[model samples]
Target: MRTSSSALFGLGLVMAVDRLVFQPDRPISDVQQTLLGIVRRVART
Candidate 1:
């Protein structure tokens, strides 16, 4: 249903961000902010 799709979508986004964060060179604080914004947008959607 809608909730399951949302949960799956959030999980996919989290994993993508985790992989991106594991790579060299991105600043932690910037990543934090970006991830937070993405999460907020996902929730709003």
Candidate 2:
């Protein structure tokens, strides 16, 4: 259940690319809101 530094770095890269990728139908605020919701849910568990 332990996460390594590389795994964390990879996750960060993925999230960064996900945020940087252009989407005509989606906005940055929506993406941020979704990420925040996920963080909140995980924090509750």
Candidate 3:
């Protein structure tokens, strides 16, 4: 449980950094977008 939670947190952190700093104006990578999608889907559940 902790491992999964930590992984989600880490993925979220990476997504946040990618959105805020790495690709603010530009498009994000497929990997990042996929991560974001997964996060969104998880949030809905």
Query: What is candidate 1's lDDT per residue for 1-45, written digit by digit as tens?
Result: 798588867866775677587854666676667766866886687
Candidate 2 residue-wise lDDT, 1-45, digit = tens: 255455545655666687677554577678667666766675577
Evaluated at residue 11, the lDDT of candidate 3 is 85
- What digit string (tens of lDDT, one per residue) describes model 3 on residues 1-45? 797789898987877787788778756576577887997897787
Q: lDDT (CA) for every model shown?
A: 0.70, 0.64, 0.79
The weakest ten consecutive residues by lDDT in model 3 span: 23-32
TM-score of each: 0.48, 0.52, 0.53
Model with the higher lDDT, candidate 1 or 3: 3
Which candidate has the highest TM-score of all?
3
Candidate 1 local distance difference test against the native:
0.70
Per-residue lDDT value at 8 in model 1 = 61
| Top of the candidates by lDDT | 3
RMSD of each: 4.3, 3.8, 5.3
Off by over 4 Å in 3: 26-36, 39-45
